[model samples]
Structure formats: structure tokens, C-alpha cells
Target: MAESKFEQSLENGAHQKIKSLVGKWKGTSKTWFEKDILADDSSSEADISSILDGRFISYDYTSSLNGKPLSGKMIIGFDIPYQKFTFSWIDSFHMGTQIMQATGNATEKGFSILGSWGNPEYGDQLFGWRTELEIISENEIIFSAYNIMPGEEETKAIETIYKRI
Candidate 1:
């Protein structure tokens, strides 16, 4: 029997690349609340691991915002049928009580995903969030996110550079 595409990926494709990220990482997180304005910069740590026999990758991280403790988890997978990447994220400081789900395609060095969030009480106003992960080298990676508002351009919200530890 021929190997399924996903199975092939697990052996030597995108899944293999994703699995390479499994490890301990230490880095610094920089956040911006307004365009061109730095809000906070702090140390951050993360653990990346493969789950479900390498079908998915989980990123669990801890940091701080405005001197308050913050933590987040993100699960990422490749959808073979859709030919896209799947991502779901939640965090203590940003998500509040909501989970952000996103889908995107692969980039040259990584992937970029877009998601949105809003409150019904706001009456149909939703904000966009874009996350990007770039693997620079065996020991380095860069993670970034942008915030998009209605009728406005996307602004860099957060960026973290990690080194494998």
C-alpha cells in the first residue's frame, strides 16, 4: 500500500520540520500596545513537544506582561486534505476566556496564520490577529503576532525570539 501524504509528511516533510521544534526554549518577548510604542519586554520560556504520534505540535510558554504573569498554549497541525496549517491558541493575558482558532499556509521558513476575536456586545466589530513562526536555525526561532482593527492597518503586537536550550 502506498503511504498517505500525511504519513509521508511525518517521515520527511512538513511534519518532520514541525517535530524539529520539539525542545526547550528560552527567549525574550517584546510587546507593543500601540504602533511604534513598546509596552513591555520580558523573558519568556517555552516547551515544544509532539503530540498524538507526531500529528500535532504543542507549544506551552510562560512570560509576563506589565509585570503580571502570563502563560499561553498553542497547538499546531497540518491538514493534509485542506493543504493548510491549523492553529489554536489561548493565553491568560490576551485570550481572557476565549480560544483563537486559525488556518494558514506554509512560508519559506515557517507558517503564518490569521484569526479573529470580538464580543457580541460590541455589535459585529471583530479584530484580526496574525501569527507567524519562523525557524531561523537549529538553535533559533522567531515568533511574532500582529493586531488588525477595522479600517486600520495591522500593527505588530508581540514578538519573541527563542533559542533552543
Candidate 2:
């Protein structure tokens, strides 16, 4: 597909935004959903405390799901000019990548990224989603995840509150 001039501008801005996310952030999160019963049970903690390195533009996220270990490395990058920010991840369970674009700049508090990813385990189905990051400070932030699937009732997948530790 042909690239639009506006897209180029956004891409450039997104790169800088991604750069901002390159730092140590710590927080906690909660999962709330209607159909996704397993995630909403709240039996275990969904807290996150991560350290992001700018040199590699990568992050080490540590958390737990149902009381099991959850950790991954997402190397953040952009395509060009800043149209979108790609999050390439690899961890104990999945070895895949997801990209989220700049929906807009930080609002009252932080920023939001809107994008979708494919879940091969879920029959390679495309899952539309968004992640909101609220910067509490230079060392702490909050991450919230939501599902924005069209035609389907909106659902909350997971929310991770992060802090720099």
C-alpha cells in the first residue's frame, strides 16, 4: 500500500514516544472481563515491575498469571517517521510480536497506544487491543490493556500496574 504524507509524520513522532517508554517502570494490574472467566477470577496477582533499557529499546517485564511466572522481553521500535510502534516480544510461552500505533499523545496524565495482534494459539485470530500507559514519574507508571474488537462486546483483558524496581 502507498504511504501517506500524514502517516510519515506520525511515524516520526511515534519513534520519539517509544523512546520515552525506554526506562525502568514499576506498577500493578488487574484483569477484568466478561467472557474470559479464567482471567477475571482474580485468584493471583497481576502486578508488574519492569526495567527498560534504552540502548536496546528493550524491556524486561516480570509478573504472574494464576500464580505462575510471567516474564518477557519486548524490543520496541518503529517502522519509519513514527506511524507505529512495534513491540517484538519473546518469553517462556510465546515467541511473537505485536505493534501498537500512536492513537494520540498523553492526555490528562499519560498516553495510549491502539493496535491489534494475532494469536496463533487462538487460531491465528486477530485481536484488536489498546494499551494505556500513565507515567507516575521517572520510575513508575501504570499499564492498562483493553480489547476493542468490533461487532463483539467490548471486554477487558488485563491491566498491569507497573513500578520501577
Candidate 3:
């Protein structure tokens, strides 16, 4: 029998790279609600681990927003058939009662995924959210997110730089 693509990935492909993210990380998070305006800057911690036999990476992180406690969990995986990265995220502060599902291809340094959300009260208008995860070195990583309004440019919403702990 021939080795499956996913199996190949697990052995020496994207999954191998994903495994590097499994560990404890401590860092600082910066958030912005308005363009060019910093909102909250606080310490954050993340625990990442391989789940389901290294098929996916689970990221659970805790931080603060405006002096209030906030946390989020994310599941990231590579889709073999689609050849893209997929992620589902839910956070106490930004997500409220919703989960964001995103998909994208790999970037030069890492992966970038995009998702969207809208409120019914807002009359079906949706906004885009893009998240990027970049591994700078064996001990350092940078995670960032952008907010995209309809018919407008994307703006940086949050950025977190983490170091292995």
C-alpha cells in the first residue's frame, strides 16, 4: 500500500512543522480597538499540544483585556485534500458566543487564515478577521490578528509575541 498524503505530512511535511508549536509559552499581548491606537497591553500565557495523534494542534491561551480576564482555545490543522490550513477559534473577549472558522495557505514564515462574522442587528453586513502565526525561532513566536471592515482596509487588532517557557 502506498503512503497517504496525510501520513507523509505527519512524517516530514507541514504536520511536522506544526508539532514544533506544542509547548508552553509566555508572552505579551497588545490589542487595538481603533486605528493606530493601542488598547490593552498585558501578559499572556499559552499551552499548546498535539491532539489526536498529532493530527491537529490545540492552543489554549489566557490573557487580560482592559484589566478583565480573558481566554481562548484554538484548533489548527492542515487539510490534505484542500492543501490549506484550517482553524477554529473561540475567545471570551472577541468571540462572545460564536466560533470563527478560517482557512488559508502557508505563508513564507508561517500560516495565515481568514474568517468573518456579523450581527443580525447589523443587517447582514459581515466583517473579516485574519490571523497569522509566525515562528521566528526555536524559542520565539508571533501571533497576530487583523480586522477587516466591509469596503475598507484591514487593521491590526491584536498581536502577541511569545517565548518558550
Q: 54-96, model 3: which lDDT tens digit per residue?
A: 8899999999998999999999999888989999999998998
My TM-score estimates for the predictions, one after another, are 0.97, 0.57, 0.97
How much is 127 displaced in model 2, in angstroms?
A: 1.9
Per-residue accuracy of model 1 over 15-129 as CA lDDT, tens digit each:
9889999999999999999999999999999999999999999999999998999999999998888888889999998888999999998999999999999888866989999
Task: Give the alpha-carbon lDDT of every model.
Answer: 0.94, 0.53, 0.94
The predicted structure with the larger lDDT, 2 or 3, is 3
Arranged by lDDT with the best first, the candidates are 1, 3, 2
Q: In each prediction, how many residue pairs overlap at the backbone (N, C-alpha, C within less than 3 A)?
A: 0, 17, 0
Global CA lDDT computed for model 3: 0.94
Clashing residue pairs in candidate 1, if any? none
Off by over 4 Å in 2: 1-25, 35-56, 78-80, 90-110, 119-125
